[model samples]
Every structure is written in structure tokens, then in C-alpha cells.
Target: MGAAVSDTSTRTTPEHEASRTPSPPGGRSRLAALGRAVARRRLLVLLLTLVVVAIAAALGGDVAQRLSSGGFTDPKSESSKAERFLADRFKSGVPNLVLVARAPGSVDAPSASAAGRELTERVAKAPGVLSAGSYWTMPGAAPLRSRDGRSALVLVRLGGSEDDFRATAKRLVPKVGGRQGVLDVSVTGSAQVSVEIEKRSEEDLAKAEAITAPATLLILLVVFGSAVAAALPLAVGLLSVLGTFLVLRLLSAVTSVSVFSTNITTALGLGLAIDYSLFVVTRYREELASGRDVTEAIAQTVRTAGRTVLFSSVTVALSLAGLLVFPLYFLRSFAYAGMAVVALAAVGAVVVLPALLALLGRRIDAWNINRALRRLVPHRRERGPATEESGFWHWLATAVMRRPVLFALAVVAVLVTLGLPFIRASFGITDDRELPASAPAHVAAQALRDDFDSGESSALSVVLPETDADAGRVGSFAARMSALPGVFRVDAATGSYVNGRQVAQPGPAAVRFRAPGATWMSVVPSVEPYSDAGTRLVQRLRGAPGAPGTVLVGGQAALLVDTRDALAAGLPWTGLIIAGTTLVLLFLFTGSLLIPLKAVVFNLLSLSATFGAMVYVFQDGHLQWLVGDFTVTGLLDISMPVLMFCVAFGLSMDYEVFLLSRIREVYMETGDNTRAVALGLERTGRLVSAAALLFATVMAAFATSGLTLLKLLGVGLALAVIMDATVVRGLLVPAVMRLAGRANWWAPKPLRRLHERLGLKEA
Candidate 1:
């Protein structure tokens, strides 16, 4: 123990030691004191942890059932208002359930017509169906018939929330779908698509768990060289996941939470648990190797690595907080789950993990596998931990520092080039194409696309709940809407219109379009519902003159437009929240204005490259073989990039904090900027690399999902972590720091005083 202190003292100059602020009177940092307390109560802490895990297990078993399958739309947008008006006034909204019935021959086959009417009547009279209409029931409804003249449409509006409608679809599809007498029937709609996505997501979650757990454990064994040491991280990971499930389950009771959040909870909880525990365990082992007593080693490990873990967790949680500013509950759910799981993982690492280690003492390294492995392969022995001036990472840092400008420019150019494709990114909502071709809902939706002349189910619904215009004026409005570009036809209370002319007079179907004091028009578009042209058509409809009353346009394209507008409005606040909190936290940790600013900017750069890759692969459909086959929509899902930015930016800052914490400690100890950078990279480079690898593995498992949205998220995050860990952390950070020199740690005088009072430092 004395020799260890002597070695540390010898490594630092007297001037550097004198320049450092002294600790409080007891000379024990709060984390160190907490570590001692934990050591004293190790048994009790483990027992309490077991009890909590047990409770979490009991309460979280039904979490999957409770999570909703939809939250993509902005509930406060005009589209939402339009939907509400339709539902409140007419007891119906857009059709979210469709059944296609196909005939064997043309000329309106008698058997197919009877089967289609029977199917529509059966569904319309069903318990959850709000309204139903078909080609056979609605007069002069040519749009309901396929262009090929084999299949006709049966559109039904299921009345409820997304979850309720999805549940109704699940109950109704299997009963009415498939062969109906002489006709072939298939059921699909937005609700059914969401149901299928939820099912696939659950399956993918299980598959991801199966792939990540054993693989992560194996990697942990190789990294730690001890089965006992490797198992500790897995245990903490499991605890964190269970705790997050409970948190999500509880949150789901009072507010909307997306089912997909379960996957994130598992991936992030396990990955961060492994990251934080690995750092703590590695530092503890190093302290033990220095001949310190078990208690003292535990205290020192908590004081340093534990503090870093806490800081890293906070940075991650704060970055995730940016998602809350968005109106979409889908993104907000991730924010909730992410923040909760990060906090739990941090607690598990710093509190529970330390207690477990304290109890184990030297047994933490029991059941060593490195010796046996080395004996089997003499050339493949595990290396010892590197010293300050040594190791491959140290060499790379020195090399990059030697020509900082050249290296910086080269790396930045590569990153910017990779990011160039994002300049042309096209954004749209997730649709049936998000599902794999093998999915039944995808097959049904594809049939609609291939057979139908226009998207009737995705028609823009122009609702006028209090229109006072006469029937002739209403007919004029419908005629004008039909003449607009992209509009195939318009159905109103007065009649059906095509190309500025009324083609059909009031019929049985026209009654549904009117009430005592209100009316609505269905403007069916010729363009794809999720296409840019579809969005433009919606904007044009909203701007069209000669409306009878207050007009609110709603439909799939309108929903997309409103959602994009909502995201655009919230994006600045989200940026401010993420960047501002990151600056404050990093400043508190490093007391350096430049480092925090650099971290925020670099994270954005790395994320830009990731977004570019997402566009090139998922949007442009260049790497279908890599991420598995998916429909090429020519536009990325609008909500995914925002979610990815929050998650990937958080993770990028996670690595940043890990590296900066070590660098700051070394800088404080030696006051040599260049030496500190080199030593810090030597100490933490392997740790960050290992953590990123494990996290990337977890995210890669998500890329195997059949859903393209999940695949985009998984592939994007994995790419971001790898790029951040390697290109950003390994190359760019050292080069930039070397160029900055002493200014890397600079702050204004007032801010320096503030940092001195509030900054985090360990004894």
C-alpha cells in the first residue's frame, strides 16, 4: 500500500501537486466514504437488491401487454383536430380496417359480390366496427374497385384508440380474413399494420435478447479473463433491465408508452450496465494489483471510476431528455425509458456492484480462464494493463498529435464526405412498407398498391362540422377539390365529382358524408399516400379557397405534414436542452468550456455521418442485403432520425465523458497537456473500445429485426457507436486536444471560480 502511494507521488511533479486543491479535512471524497459504508453493509445491500429485483420481476411481467403500438402522430396538430371533429360529430373517422375480396373472373362475378357484401356486413355489425362501406354497397363508387377488375375494397372504420383498434383488428382479422365462399379475402389497414409491427417487435426483442446475452457474456469473459468477473456485469445488466421494465410499466399506467421501448430498455440497460461495471471492475482489479487491502481498493475504485460512471450516466440521461420536447409519445416514451434505465444501470454499477465486489474481495477474479486458454494456445496470451507512456493507444495518440492539423483535416473530410448523402434525405411516416414482405399485412398493403387505382383509405378528409353552405355550394367545393392536382376524385354530401365535374348525384353513400349541421369530403389522391407529392397535395387542399366553413384537412398525408411541422417546431428546443445540459454537465466535470463545446460539435458530426448512412442504406435502398430486404420508400421515417439523434448523441457523449474523465484526472495529476492526453488514451482507450463493441453487438441484434424502422434504429446506432469510438474518440479527440494545447482546459475567470466551487473532483 505504501509502495503504491510512493509510485503515484513519484509520477507527479511537486509543482503539480502543490497547484492542486486540497481535499476536505477527512481527506475522503463522498464517493469514497459511500464505498466504505457499502463495504461495511455489503450483505444488507445485496439482500435489498434481491428484494427489489424480485418485486420488479413480479410487477413487470405484464409490461409488454400494457405498452401501446402507436404514438407517431402529433395529438395537438390540426390533423388531430380534424379527426376529433369527425369522430365527435359523425361517430366515425378514417377507415383503419380494410378487407380485399377477389373474384375468380371479371364482370362483377355473382359469387364474389355476395361474398364481399356478406364480409362487409359481418364486419360492420361486429362489436368494434364503427362504420363499413364497400364497392357493392356504395353506389357509383368506382374507386372501390381495382383497376385490374378482380379485387374490390371493403373499408371499415374501427372505433377506438390505436391500441383498442389494434386489439379489435387482431380479434376480427382471423375470423373474417382468408377464403370467404368463392372469393379470396385479406384484411389490412393502418391499425392492422401497427398490430403486425407490435408482434414483430416482440419477436425481435426476444431474438435480440437471445443473441446479445450469451454473446456479451462471452466477450466479457474474454475481456476480463475470469468467469466470475464476467458474470458480475451480466448480473447488474439483468437487474437494471428488470428495474427499467418496472419503471416503464408504472409509467404506462398514467401516460402513453410505446411497446418498442421494451427493446430499448433491454439493450441500453444491459449495454450500460456492462460499460459501467467493466470500468469499475477493471479499476478495482488494478487497485488490488497495486497491493492495496480489499476495503481500501473498493474505496479508491468508487472514488474514481464510480464517479465517472455517475457522470457518464447523467450525460446519457440528459441527452435522452431532449426527446421529451416532441409531441409524439413514441419519442417521449424512449426518453422516459432511457432516463430511467440509465439511472438504474448507474445505481447498479456504483452501488450494488461495489457491494458485491467488496463481499467477494480477491474472489472477484476466481475461476480464471486466461491461464488455461494461454496453455492451449501459447501465442494467444492476454496482455497486462498498459502503463501511462506505453500501449498501442498511447502510440496512436502521439502519432496523431505530432501532425494535428493534417490528421484533423483528414478525419473531418472523411466524416463530412460520409455525411454528404444526408443533404438529400427525404422524410416520411412509417407505413406498411416498414414491415417485411413476408408479413401478411405487408402482402395485403402491397396488393392494394398493385391493384387499386387510387388510395381511398388514405384520402384527405376535409371536415366542416358547422358548414352553413347550401347543397350547391358544397357541390362546387367538391368539384374544386377534385380538380386539384393529385386528386383522383372527391366524394361529398352533394355528389361524387371528378375533374371539376359532378359525375354522380346523391346516393346511399352520400348520406354518410352528411349530418344535420355538418359535412365532409373525401379527396382521394392518385399519388402514393406517403410520397412527397402526397404531402404537397395535402398542403394545396388546405390552401384551396371557397370553403363553406372552418376547414380542417386530415388523413395519412395530413398526419405526416402535421407531424413534420410539430417536429420542426420542437427541434430547436430539443437541441437547446441536449446541448445546453451537456455543456453544463461537461463543464462541471472538466471545468473546460472548450472541451464541452468540442464534445457537442463532434457528437453532431458523428451523428451526421450516421444519418447519412441511414439515408444511403435504408432510404436510398443501397444496402438491402446488409440490413435484410425492405421496401424502398425513397424517404426515411420522419420520427426515426429524431429518436436516433437523441439516442446516438447520448451514447456518443457517453464515450466522451468516459475519455474526458480519465484525461481530466491525469491532467490534474501531472499538469502536462500532451502527456495527459497520451496517458488518458492509454488508460481508457481499450475500455471505451470494449464497451462500444459490446454496445454495438447489442444494437446489431436489433438490426436483424424484420421491421425496417427497428432495423434503421439498430444499424444507425451501431454505426454511430463504432464511428464515435474509433474515428471520433481514437483519432479526432487526440489530434484536436494536441492542437488546443493548454487552452483545452481554459475557462473564463468567473466561470473558473464557479467551477472551483461546483466542479466534481475526487481525492
Candidate 2:
């Protein structure tokens, strides 16, 4: 049962009217007024909150079904255009459905050949199949037959929308896969890969939630020292996650939203809810302990901690908003989910939470677990400081300040050393290897890598939009392409060429390369499709002459190049948005240019260290023992670093705001910088560390995901949070403040006037 609010001083009409008539030298505080409003109508607020949450839960029940499993390519890129060109003009693009067929003996046996041809023809007649070819059907296609002579590939191109392709694959695989006469078959390709990833992601999310929910509740119970207090944050987190799912579901109807965003929604929802709740509830308990009654304690908590929550949420949301600058919806989807969850979490903490606190009052301190712990141990000290100057954090801060230069140098050196490995970091696109080894798609891909002679399924498509079916001109261009380094063969209207020689005359396959004014050829490569050599080959092909008309190259390699260029072009703007907004917001909060600068610098350092650690473990494959096993592709996914930076930087700034707000409060009360730093650390030290530990626990649960990218995100963010809280906030902050001294709070005269007029500080 919840406690009833007995304080009637602010509930009376006369008192409320007097409170509204504000005249205190400084302007009226909106946050404090909001607190009073929630207090005055606590029952209505709770009822409305529950109604909204129930609506969200209902609307978002089928959100996972609505989400897309892929958005990694820029739809406007040239590679995407070329792909569309092939499917539109020639009714064919790259093979998106592959059947790897094996025989009891050689695939060339009569029974195996008959089964393979039947399989190919069956797939060609399927609803969404554009065209299908195989080792048995296409003459001079030696690469499709594995070197061991037992396995062969049946490549089928499916033409439709992405959703249509997924539907077709789901239908066709079950009907035509498994066994065909004397041949045994396994299915793979982009369609199958997408289906597998979607399934794995859903499984990972369910498992992560199962792990984090009870673990986080137990951690919160320990951190708050009471069951009633701990339950509030979990309630807020549930509301935030469910609310974000509704937002994402609505967004998916209008635009593409990635299924991967669901993982981020759950992780950040719980993490931030716990963070803001810790700040608010802890501050409320402190006010109550300092002798404020239910009403005033709620009001003060809202005025101070609620404002900090507001400012911190803005910083985090802005950082995530930077992802919108990227062309790929994969990254943009995260921006959508992250900003939505942050807004909902802040609202839940600042509004609904205070209302609940008003209803509960001193009952929040009921079911005290720490009291039982104290009784059991009898000698262990209680959590918070007995005095401002006597706590462990206070002692640590003072000790660091005493040797500022040494502490700063030592901390910087450690961070820089951790960041060294990132200098050699390489980037590539994710493939089937992102799935667990046991996944069917991954198993099929491994068979291709080991058995196949060349990467035929991942060939480059060079389209000449205005070219006709002229034998001389087409054959010349095909010869030049086949001569290029890493190219295995080129299939054109004229013929199939290898090493600058026409090895076979035009056949049935060559007929597919021409339609009206448009013609296309596929340049198959011998190198790994997503490797460094493949990239180099794409660059060379783009520059190679001998085109009858305009040449547009498209494939996995071209897509990689275009995506990389797009990211490079958009990165400056993303950085500008994040950095510019962060500077302006921090200045408004602290009324100090130097403090904001220091915060940004420290955040960059912390994030660089996180990136370096990721490169070391995920990129170079050093710690598979600790983070679990994964295929070491020798290059990290190109989108992952950018995604991680935005998420981790925003979270690191969350801790910065928490520490700086408390320090500014102390400094405003006492003019001594050293004492403010020490006292602030003493007050919030346990709280920040506890918040980071709990958030890290949530991220760590997701780190156990079978998807390597998800694992990288979890491990990287967990490291960033812990390092920021302990090393950067706890150690470097005090040392830097000691060295900066009085200048840390200084600004120009005009800026100071502006700050005094419109700054976001509490009175």
C-alpha cells in the first residue's frame, strides 16, 4: 500500500494563489512550478500516465513484425541505382537466393546433374524469381562448381521490393530446399541472411531482457537500500521502453526503421531511467533527511534534480540526433529510438515519478534492505558520507588535487595508451559472419568460402545505360574488365572473357545482358568481396576506360565504397552538430566556457579509449575468450564505430552533467573551488558509481548476444560508462579543476550578461 500525502499547506486555494504571485529578485522557476502542479494533482497525473502507457503497450505489441531487418545501403548511392537499373531493364541483378547442392559422389554424375537442373528450373518458375542459373544449366561457368567436384551453386535472382524478397525467400526456401532427387541442398544469400538476422536479433533481445530485468532490480535494491524505492525506476524503465516501441512502430509505417533499433531502445531505456531516477530519488531522500516535509522535499527535488535531468536528456538526445546526418537508415533508426526513449524517460522521472513520490511519501524508505545488511555485518560502514569532508570520494578528490600535475599526466597517459590500437583500425561491411557459427546462413557461407573457386554471387555489375548490343564495343569493354587485377571473369553480351581473352562465345546467359538501349555485364572477382583487395579492384574498375556509353558499377564492392564516402561526407556535419550543441547547452547550464570545453575534451578522451579497446578486441580478435567467440573478419563493421561514438559520448556527458551540476551548486554556496570539488564528489560519488554499475550491467547483458556487432556495442558502451564514472569523473575532473582554479568559472562580460538573463541554473 502507498502512503497518503498529509501536508496540506500547498493544497489550499489561498496558499496556491500566493505561491503563483512570484517576486523574488530572480525570475520564476518553471521546474519548481511544475513540481507544485504535479503535487497538487498527483492522483490525476498517475491515472493519465497509466492510461498513456496502456495505449502504448497495445499499439506496440506487434512492433517487431513491422521493423525491417536491413537498411545498411544508401538507397540514393550509385550502386543502388545500378542495382535498380539491372532489375528494371534486364529483369536481373545479383543472385539473392543461392542453393548449394551436394551429391553422393561428383556433382557431374547423371542423377546429380538432373536434380540440379530440375532445382534451377523450379526456382526460375517461382513467383518472385527474376532469373535463375546453375552449374548444370550454364555452359562455361566453371567457377560455380566447387573444386572438390561434389558441391555446386544454383544462383537465383529475385526481383521485387525488399519486403517482397523476404516473403518470397521465406516461402520458397521451405518448399524447394533440403533434398532434390540424388542431391542434398542448403539455402543461403541476402534473403536468407536477412531472415536469420531478424530472428537472432529478436532472440537476443528476449534473452537480454530476461537477464537485465531481475539483475537490475536486484542492483537497484542494493543501491537504494530499499525495495519500494528500487521498484520505481523499473516502472519508469518499462514505460520508457514500451513508449519508444510505439514511436518506432509509427515511424516504420511512414519510413524504414531497423529491427536493430529495438535492442538500443531496451538498453538505453532502462539505463537512463535508472540514472535519472537515482538522481531524483536520492536527492529527495537527502532533502527529507535534512528535515523537509513531503511537499517541500518533492518540490526541491524537482527544482534541482529534475532540471539536471532535463538538461542531461537534451544533451543525450542531441548527440543521438547526429545520426540523422547519415544516409543509411540503419544508423538513423538508432537516432529515432534513442531520442524517443530519452524524452520518455525524462518525462517519467520528472513528472510521473514526483507524483508517485508524493503519494508514497516516507513509505519510500520502507522495506529497508540496508538495515538488515548492517545488522548482519555489524562493522561495515553505511553508504553515504557522515560529513562532507570525511567520505572516501572527498578524500580521493583532495588527494588528487594535492598533486594535480602528476594525477592529470598519469591519467592522460593511461587513456592515450589504451587508445593506441585504434590507429590501425580497418573498416568493412558486415556479412553472414555477423551471425553465430551455428546459424544456417553462416554455415552455408563458410562452405562457399572454403569450396568455391571465386565469389560469383558477389560479382560487380557494370551497367551502360545507352549502350546497344554491339559485339565489337561490348567485347572490348569486357576484355578490359577481365584483365583487371583480382577479376576472375567478365560476362557480357559479346561473350565470357578471362585474362583479356574471350574463352567462350555468347550463349543463353549473354542474352540476359541486353534489353533495348541498356546493357550490363557482371565482373566476377577472385578475391573476397568485402576485403581490401576487393575495394582496390572496385576503384580500378571505376577508372577503367573502354565503355561504349556511361559506365555505372554496382555490387557489394561498389556499395562499400559509396557507403564509406557518404559517411565521410556526413561525418563533419555530425560532429559539428554534436559539438556545437553540447558547448552551447553546457554554457547555459554552468555559465562557464572553460567548464564546457573541459567536459568535451574529457569526453573525447574517454570515447577514444573505448574505440581503441573495441579495435583491439573486436577488430583484431584478441579477447574472444572473454567476450565470447566470433568470426574475426580482421575489420570492424564500418557503421559500428560511428554508432558507438554517438551513444557512448552522450552517456559520458550524462555523468559529466551530474558531477558538474553538484559541483556548481557547492561553488555557488561557497566561493572556494577546492572545497566545492571535494564536497560535490563526496555527495554524488556513490550515486554516480552505482548508476554506472547498473547501466553497465544492462549493457553487459546485451554483450552476450550471438551477433558480434551487438556484442561490440554492449562491451564498448559498458567500458565507456565505467571508465567515465571512475577514471574521468572521479580522478581527472578534480585534478583539472585544481589546476584551472578561478578561471574554470570565468566568461566574457557579454556572455555573462546573456547567461544571467537566460541561463538554466536553479535558484
My TM-score estimates for the predictions, one after another, are 0.96, 0.95
Global CA lDDT computed for model 1: 0.86
Error of 2 at 10 (Å): 38
Q: What is the lDDT of residue 451 in candidate 2?
A: 89
> Compared to the true structure, candidate 1 yields what TM-score?
0.96
Clashes of each: 0, 0
* lDDT string, candidate 1, 1-763, tens digits: 1121112232444333432555342424678899888988999999999999999999997798899989999999999898878777776777888888888875288877887788788988998888899998886854788888888899988876777888899899989888888778887889889989999999999998898878888899988889999989888888899999999999998999999899899889888998898899989999999999988899999988998899899999999999999999999999999999999999999899999999899998798998777778758455877465657888888888877899999999989999999999998887788898978888988898888878877878998878842545788988999999999999887888999999988788777787777888888899977778989999899999998777899999999999999999999999999999999998877778899999988998898899999999988899788877888889998999899999999999888988887787777876777777887888889888999999999999988899988888888999999999999998999989988877788777788767667777654
Model 2 TM: 0.95
Deviation in angstroms for 450 in model 2? 0.6
- lDDT string for model 2 (78-122, tens) is 889998999988999888888899999999999999999999999
Per-residue lDDT, model 2, residue 648, is 88
Instruction: Please state the error at residue 392 of candidate 1 in Å.
Output: 0.9
Q: What does candidate 2 score in Cα RMSD to the true structure?
A: 6.5
Which model scores highest in lDDT? Answer: 2
